[model samples]
Target: MEMFLYYIHLFARNVKRTPLFFALVILTLSIGIGTLLANLSMLSLMSTDPIPGKSEQIFNVNMNTYAGANNRFGSMHVLRYSDAKAILDSKVANNATMHYSSMVYSRRADSQDLTRYASPTRATTASFFEVMGAQFAHGEPWKNEHSNNIVIGHELNVKLFGGANSVGEKLELQGKIYTIVGVLKPWEMRPLFYHASEGKAFDKTDDIFVPIEVAIDNNWAVFARTMSTDSYTTLDQTRQINAYYIQVFVELLDDKQHLAFQTFIDGYANQLKEKGNHRHEVDNRLYNVNEWLDKNEVVNKDLLAFTIATGLFLLVCIFNANSLMLSRYQASQFEANLRRAVGASKKQVFFQGVVESIILGIICALLSFVLAFSLLALYRQLFDELAPVAELPLHMLVIGLGVALTSSLLSTVYPLIQGTRTSLASILK
Candidate 1:
């Protein structure tokens, strides 16, 4: 501790001699680290698996069951209601859920309030809450088979009921009174992996979760794509073999279960082929959560390109910082020789240089964090498409500091060696 303090004192004295040189080095590194950190924060948010514990266990099912000349929907991930029902009935995996999204305008029933709010809704089965690992702050999912029961998210809870536990309350939607059975906690799922292909990955989860049967029975207007081979006049006609829409996810607990589930889906496809429902050969694909995100291109390509570009810029900053460090140390060569003549060791000189670089690195890290915030705001304002994933998390602050410290240490190596090796006789002569 005393050695570090002494070295730090020596470093402080050197900075006083050439403050501008040190400032320039730190500023150079700050810009590079700042840009890299900003992009890295967004990239990490997009690529990270929202459901960490069971991501590997969950799999998305895709099949080539479309038998039409158009082939618009190449790999049919979204299935018709009939196809979804068939998969649910098979029950070959540990757990699975089929769902499609919609948007609805809802208002409180039997209330004096005159405002109606537009909310995103999820039409899914009971297993959806379990499969997606939803946590509840009040009430729970419906116990019986009824479409009148609904689940509301935290945002909706705040909007409609002033953030109260509105479980037993009634909501009026589409000229119907529905009972709220559950209220969710403040939950955030990045790249909402379950529906990444729908372009709502970075968006918040639905405001309401209702039964798929009720949604099917009433024919909820399909806000998303309802791909079909045959001309369908209504959403109710989506149950036909020619139409495909709902997305499916299954949970396989072990390798045995995975293999069995794969075989089951493939066989189901083959059976459809045999029955002449599907003309294509058996072609089915399954992707785990992380794999699904990659397959669907969830991360912004422009953000990734920015990350790579900023990474190269950081390298350039490192080179420039190194040159500055060499010049600073070169100016102190005579002092270093005199100190050596006065019995100072090479290790002492080296430690002093190291201490200075580390302090500069620490300063750079702090400054870079501020720059990162500004850059993130600028990027979001410049590109509205990447706004959802632009914010930085706490962990990223540690990463920025680590990078700054490491970069500074690396940049000072050659300079430290050069300064510490100056001969005493050369200076005395």
Candidate 2:
């Protein structure tokens, strides 16, 4: 420990003598480390399991009932309303929830301020809260499925009620009065598995949630894609039509339940085939949360390619630092040889170099954080849709430090060897 501190003191004096060289090394390495760290942080967020423990159990339902082309992959992730309702009514799974996205103009019902904000809404069933593991801060999910009662997200609550518990308060949506039965706590689900398709995976959670039936009754317009041969003017008309819009997710506890649900889905498809409602072959599938995300391609391929490029850039930076350190060490050969002539072993010289590299690593790591933050900010500006995931979480911070230290040590290896191997007789003369 004493020797390490002594080496550190020597390193400080060396830096004082040639601060510009060290500064250049640190800047070069920080740029590479910071860029890599920024990319990694976003990638980590993009690929992380939105639901950790139950990700394997919660499944997204898909039925290849598309009339256009039955064998087309990824064409049937969304389901028709009837299909979603049938699956929910079957009671085959441990829990099930179905929803369709919508948009509405909302305001406090009794507020004298007539201004209304455009709100993203989820027209879902009562089980959505439980199935999605949403945390409630004030009240609970409404008991009545078709009632005017609704739920508000924390952000919406803050906007409407100043973050107070506003349960049982009245809210106006598109001029229709609805009671708030629940207010959610601050929660974010990355790669939002429920609606991962249609390029909406990284979007924020809906500001409001209402029962699907009530939404239909009130004619809340569907905010997502709806495909049908028949023309549908309202959400109610979507119920009986062949329009494919709603997304369904169900929780099955075990493989047995999963198989059972699959069997049931097959039987249901067969029934449709018998009734001539479905002309396509039965190709029903159940994708767990991660599988669903993969099917939807939630992780951007372009970002992945960019990450690889950043890794290569980091390598270039490492080599550049190595060259800089080589030059610095070559210039210090006189100092190294003088120590060797005065009884300092080659091993001791190498150890001193190692300690100096470690100090440089520590400084590089601290500076890298600032550079990484700046790069992340730039990424957020360029990729507005990915702004939510462009953050340095705790694990990514640790990884940055580890990478910086490893790079520093690696860059110093050949330099240290060459410095320690130099002849001492000339310096002693």
Candidate 3:
């Protein structure tokens, strides 16, 4: 520790002598490290499993159901309402659910005001809450009354029912009276891993979660996919075999369940093929949370490109740091000669140089963290794609420190080696 403190003191003195040069080196390092960290933060946020415990169990379902070899919907990422319903009906997995995004207006039943706001909704099943680990702050999910009962989120509860429990309270949605059966706790799933394909991955939690049957019966309009074989006069027509617009997911744990689910998918596709209605190739896919995000590219591609660029910039910064350190070490040749003459060994000089590099790394890391925050904010502002992104966690300080120390050590190897290996007699002359 005493040796380390002495090295630190020497490092500080060197920096005090060449303040601007050291400052520039630190700034260059900060820019490189900060940019890299920002992109890493985004990648981490988008790729994290939203449902950690259930990610392995739950799988997103995809099938090529479109007829004809050149159909646009062939090899797409959605299923027909009938296909999704069939998968759920097969019960091949432990639990399963499908949902589609919709907008519905809601108002307090007792309110005399004619005002209402369009609520973003999830027309899902009771199993959805279980599959997604959605916590309930109030009542439980409805048992018998699926259509007439609704689940409201925390913000919606505050807006409609004054932040009360709101269980059993009457709320009117799309001109139909429904009882609030449950109120969700504050829920946020970044990249909305389950619904990434629908373009609502970063959207706010749904204000309403209604039964799929209720959503279908009430004719809730869908904003996601709607591929059709023919024009539909009624909303029910879209729910037919020809129209494909539902997102399905199943929870298959053991190999038995997986095999069963896979068989179900293949058998269903074969049935359609045998019936002469299916023309496209049979392509059924199942992806977990991380796989789903990867398949859908939830992480912004530009951010990934930026990551690679920042890595190269960091390499350049390291080279620059190495060059600057070479100059600094060369400037201390007189000191090195004097110390070597006073019986300091080459090993001691090398250790001192390494300690100085570590000190530089420490300073660089501290500066980079502050710069990273600013850079991240600025980057998010400049790129609209990064809007509504999650921020880096406080624990990223450890990562920054590791990066800085590793960078400094790597940058200093050649310069320090040459500086420490000087001939004492030649230098004394």
| lDDT for 185 (candidate 2) | 92
lDDT of 1 at 133: 94
Error of 3 at 161 (Å): 5.3
Q: lDDT tens string, model 3, 174-250?
A: 99999999999999887787688856677777899998877887788887877777677666666665777788888
lDDT of each: 0.86, 0.90, 0.82
lDDT of 2 at 266: 95
Candidate 2: tens digits of C-alpha lDDT, residues 287-314 = 9999999988888888899999999999
Residue 84 lDDT (model 1): 76
- How well does candidate 2 match the true structure in TM-score terms? 0.94
Q: Write the per-residue lDDT of candidate 1 for residues 58-135, one digit (tens) a residue.
A: 998888878686665667687767767788888998999999888888898967986889998998888888899999
Please list all clashing residue pairs in model 3, or write none if there are none: none
- Model 2: residues >4 Å from true position, as ranges? 68-75, 343-347, 422-427
Model 1 lDDT, full chain set: 0.86
Estimated TM-score per prediction? 0.94, 0.94, 0.89
